[model samples]
Structures are given as C-alpha cells and as structure tokens.
Target: MLLQTIFYVAIAAEAMTAALAAGRRKMDWFGVCVLACVTALGGGTMRDTVLGHYPLTWVEDPYLLLICCAAALITIGLARFMEHLRWPFLLLDALGLVVFTILGCDVALEMGQSPIIVIVAGMITGIAGGIMRDVLCNDVPLVFSSELYATVSIVTGVIYFFGLQFGFPGEAVIIAAALIGFALRVAAIVWKLEMPKFVYDKELR
Candidate 1:
C-alpha cells in the first residue's frame, strides 16, 4: 500500500515535469500528453523490460495513463503560474527520483538480484524517464550533467539495501532512504554540488 502510494506520487511528479518541458517547447495538447506519458512511465518500462516483467503497468492499468494525460492538461492550464514556481517542480522531481529508485531496488531484490544489479536497476528506473524526456525535448539529459541527479539514485539504493541488510523495519528503511536521498538532492541544488566533469580539448590532445 505504501509502495503504491509512492508510485502514484512519483508518476504525478514526473508527468508534471514532462508537462513543463513540453510547455517550454510550445507543444500541442497531444504532444504534451505523449511527453508526459513517456517521462512518467519510461523508466519503469525500461526496468521491467530488462527484468522480463511482463505486461507493463500502464498497459495493465489504463488509469495510470489517464493520470499522466490529466496531469499534462492541468499543467497546460497553469503554465503561466508554474513558470514562477520552478523550484517546487524541481523538489517534486527529486522526490520522484527517490521513489523510483526505491521501487526499482525492491523489484530487483524480489527477483533475487545481486547487490550491484539491484543498485543499477534502481539507477535505471530513476533516470531513464528523464533521459527520454530530454532527448525528446532536444536538451541534454539532466542525469548526464545535473548536480547529483544520478548520484542520489545510487545512494538511495545503497541506503535501502543496507538498511534491510541491517534488519531495519521495511517502512523505516523506505522513509529513511527517501529522506536521505531527497536531502542530498536538495543540498546539491542549494550548494551547487556536482561531480567533476571530464573535458577533452583538441588543442591539448
């Protein structure tokens, strides 16, 4: 039940982010809906495909599809207001990353995957959607360059795995992992924290 709640919240958050991206691009309603669905469900779809989990969630649950479309439409109506509140959407995106990471870890662990695979799965689930979103929007994916985006997902997975290994209650582990991941993301934004970039200069080479 807790997982379901988190999953829905994550989807909604992702859909809103997608909608905002679409708005920036001045896409039509159909385009907005398409991007919203891709951003909201693309990560889980990739995870399930890799894990051989059949019948994708959106396919099996049409309501989730409806939710994404509805979210996009709502965002369209409030695009002007949302333009001034980008920080809230950024926070929501951070929350979505944690939720997706934990859910992916849970799924991989259930499948008896190794620690490494579980962590990788979590990262994939957390970032794939955003990757697709940026690709469609003609922008570099945030995961590839943004402050601690993918790092937060990996850390969340690690926290969840170790918390369970240490025998923490499941609910406690979930809350702890989410809070820690969200804090790291918020700190990254506030402090301008980032991983060092590798640059290639043709002249130097």
Candidate 2:
C-alpha cells in the first residue's frame, strides 16, 4: 500500500509535467489530460500485462484512476506555469524510475523470478512509461537522449535486486534506489552529462 501510494504521487507529478509540455504542442484540454494519464500509467499497465497480471493495477484500483483524473485536472489548470514544470518533471521522472524499478523487482522476486530476470523486468518497468510518453508526444524520449536516464534505472534495479537478496525491507530498498536515481538524474542534468554518440558518416553514392 505504501509503495502504491508513492507510485501514484510520483506519477501525478509526472503527469503535471507532461501536461505542461503537451500544452505547448497545442493539445486540447481533453487531449492534455489524456496525455497526462497515459504518460503516468502506460508503463505500469504494460509491466502488469507482461507479468501476466489481468486487469492491471490501475484497473483493479479505481483510486488510481481517480488519482490520474485529479492529476490531469491540476496539470491542465497549471499550464501557464511551464517554466517551473521542468524541474518537477525531471525529479518525478527520476523518483518514479527508482520506485517502479524496485516495485517491479520486488514483485518478480515474490513471484520467484530469478535475480537476473527480476533486474531486467524492474529496469523495463522503470522506463516504460517515459518511453510511451515521449513516443506519443512525438519527441525524442529521455531514455533515447543519451542522458543518464537508463543508467539510473539499471542502477536502481540492481540495487533493489541485491537489497532484496539481503532481506532488506522492500520499502527501504525502494526509497534508497529512488534517492540515488533522483540524485544521479539531477546531477546529470546539472552537469550536462550524457552518453557519447557516434557521428554518422554518409557514404558517397
């Protein structure tokens, strides 16, 4: 229950950021809300489906839907404050990645998944929603951006994987991962850190 609550709050904040970005693209009010909800929940839905859970978490809990709706409304109303949205979005994204990663790994661990498989599943769940959001928004997603995005997820996932092995409280593992991920993300952004990219060479026809 605690993890779920944290997930909702992180997603809600992320939704607000997404809505602000979507507004600049001229999305209608309804469209904005849709984007927000989709960005917030799309990944978890996919994670649950991949794990063979029917109905998904949000579907089973109407409170999740209600939370999404509330997030959408709040985001739409705050559209004029686009400048301040960036920090919160980045923060939420990092925190969400860590929490989701831990939750995914924890779920897999409970389901008897092997350590390696659990880590992979956790990493996937961490970044899935952001990927969906970026694709839908027609922008280059953060994960694809050469930033420290996926690195954060993988690191946190690994942390959760090992922490659970040592019998750490699941919540503590999650919180530790979240803090690390969030800090790494913020540091990367602040330092303009990114993965090196290769320059594509065009051959003469």
Best by TM-score: 1
Q: Worst lDDT window (10 residues) for model 1?
A: 196-205
lDDT scores of the candidates, listed in order = 0.91, 0.77
lDDT of model 2 at residue 120?
76
Per-residue lDDT of 13-128 in model 1, one digit per residue for the tens?
A: 79988998998898999999999999999998999899887687678888999999999899888888987878988888888999999999988898899999999999989999
Query: Can you tell me which runs of candidate 1 are displaced by over 4 Å?
Result: 203-205
TM-score for each candidate, following the candidate numbering = 0.95, 0.89
| TM-score, cand. 1 | 0.95
- lDDT of candidate model 1 versus the reference: 0.91
What is the TM-score of candidate 2? 0.89
lDDT per residue for candidate 2 within 137-201, as digits (tens), equals 88888787767887887888887778767899877877777788778878888897888877779
User: Candidate 2 at residue 31, lDDT?
Assistant: 80
Each prediction's total of clashing residue pairs, residues at least 3 apart in sequence or on different chains, is 0, 0
> Which parts of model 2 are misplaced by more than 4 Å?
169-171
